[model samples]
Target: MKRSHIPPLLDRKWLAPLLITSSLSLLLFLSFSLINAKFPPPASGFSGGGSSSELPRLPRLAYLITGTKDDGARVKRLLQAVYHPRNYYLIHLDLEAPEGERLELARYVKSEGVVREFGNVMVIGDADLVTAQGPTMIASTLHAIAVLLKRAKDWDWFINLSASDYPLVPQDDLLHIFSYLPRDLNFLEHSGDLGYKEVERARPIIIDPGLYHLKKSGVFYAKERRSLPASFKLFMGSAWVVLTKPFLEFCVWGWDNLPRTLLMYYTNFLSSPEGYFHTVVCNHKDYQNTTINHDLRYSRWDNPPKQHPITLTMEHLDDMVRSGAPFARKFEKDDPVLNRIDKELLMRLDGRFTPGAWCMGSSRAGKDPCLVSGSPIVVKPTLSSRRLEKLIANLLDPETFRGKQCK
Candidate 1:
């Protein structure tokens, strides 16, 4: 008697109301999701932090661009090629260059509207005779580094380039890829195997006149030979280098005696620039493992090699692009290849800085985009960054990294 047929509630009337209720709930959920997508929460870091995902802070580079007599114009050109507001540049024209030329370069830096606005570029007033084959080159390089450290406080890496060196990619492209790298890594191409240097360099005792003389001169070989260093192993390679600020500071300040001792040892050594930093970094326990063993520079050598690398030209363009290095060296002044690099790779105007995301000014005809500057942290990387990323990945491979370090 109690089982009266409560009609089954699976009726069309009930179905319509149930579907409408479900649809409203779905719409409300979608609206809420879209609103959060449009305006995400603020990042936990300081103002203008890159992303909330903990992306690494962009690193700044300290550049030492050195030149000799007749290099004034080339140095100026190289400055524009690699100029970035976030980085610091210390340009040196060794004592060999005339005062007029150095003044001209200073005038050029002062006259550039962008350079003046950022105030990141400087020219060394007092110079020394940097003999290419003597220890004086090393002294000049160290002087430039000390100047950079004193003038700028926030740079992370120090790069040494000559007037002959040229950039293979845009500064933005290079900096964007470097942002992901470890700050402690030092890029120096070095080796324990001395090869011909064992007989030619290690055993020789030479005296560099430029070290003591105001006038430019060459190093002379002495009558007696000397023994190889017993304390620290010798390493030598390309004179060009990209080093970390901490490592350079360690070198310049010499809180540790190794840097000073090595400096004294290399004083009489021929071509000390090739071996000073290499030996110092390799011998030290802390910096030995940080060596990347790659200079990240593209250079050409003749068969059996000569004292100097062959000048790069258009013929080397394809190989250079494939090498994925950030810079290439031994380019002749005003070479045709440099023009092509400016036009294609760096997107630089004839007399202007290479344009990047920080350049907020108009790019109208005959006008420079970098004339009006923007935030220094903003970077617009190009496809070349992918190439640099690949190069870094190969360098950092676990199987290969340890094997290449300090060996």
Candidate 2:
């Protein structure tokens, strides 16, 4: 092809300037792109090219749901109640449960078409023996966390629950509200008030046989007691937690020795689950400010409380809702209250997943809308979200948030 004609005088001066300007602009753009890629904006605020009112990316929750013998059905029920395509779930039936129970759970997980499609749920084949009040519980939780961190790289928070626990709100409500929150916030009930725990828990030395044994057994206390730690203050609270991914990584990877040190220390501590994460988060300067002293679970303890909270019943239904807690514990297997929750709060029916924005199918004649899946990021929150929002607001308030930290 013949070259197009150009004015010689115009070409000589303008072409060189134009080329230089364009080349300079390209170099500047690439440099800025590299910088942006290397060090993106902080997760707290909006990055470039988005409206200020636009919400942040939705969070993915990693759940560790544990149970014992005869809890396989309950575990499946709990999983259905909280199922969301965006989140990851690891079902762990401890070694106390029979191998058949574990296999049944695995088979059920495999059978669910939606769960199979999403590939977010797993059953632990090699289960851990988790003594309720022992360090083995903590070990099981941490193991689940490690598995989640390895398998699902994008989950934002880790939550531990038992088959006895159930959600008070839909997963959409939780995910929607959490989309507006800072990813670093760790929701753990913590207090340094050693009160009776000093005598009952901290000073006691116990051995968890579950750690070294194939069969489950209670933790036995030594005849002699030990003095409290001078190196770190003891903090204790509810074992149930909603922890940030970064904090869990710190615990699992143990870049700093504090987590490992506390792990070893808590190995012999009674009810270690209640104190291990609390003490670790409180003692670490990086995580202390991130603590939001609440486990986001509602339970009715008896007068002078017992080992476990009272089994939640229909009588506690009104209180459970009003508490604005996302979860409640110690419900009896197949309780009527759970059915009520399914009918009311969750709008879930028998043998169906809780309906959410991601569920695209029709819902006439008591059908599951979640039969057809949609984008997981599409969060259409319900009125239940307002309750969670209120709870979170109160927790984040100056009087409760900072004032209650590590205290």
* TM-score, every prediction: 0.87, 0.87
Best by lDDT: 2
Task: Report residue 281 deviation for candidate 1 (angstroms).
Answer: 1.1
Tens digit of lDDT per residue, candidate 2, span 1-407? 11112110111111100101111111111011111122222232222112345445778898988999999999989999999887888888888899899888888777887777777887777777788888888887877777777667888899999999999999988887777677788899889997878899999899999889988888899999999889998899999999988788778777677887898899999999999999999997787877888999999888876779999999999999998999999899999999999999999898889888778898888667888886666666777778887788777765556689888
After aligning candidate 1 to the native by TM-score, how far in Å is the CA of 294 from where it should be? 0.7
Model 2: pairs clashing at backbone N, Cα or C within 3 Å: 192-407
Candidate 2 global lDDT: 0.79
Which pairs clash inside model 1? none
Off by over 4 Å in 2: 1-53
Candidate 1, residues 137-214, lDDT tens digits: the string is 887788777766666787889999999999989888777777766677889889989898877877898898887889
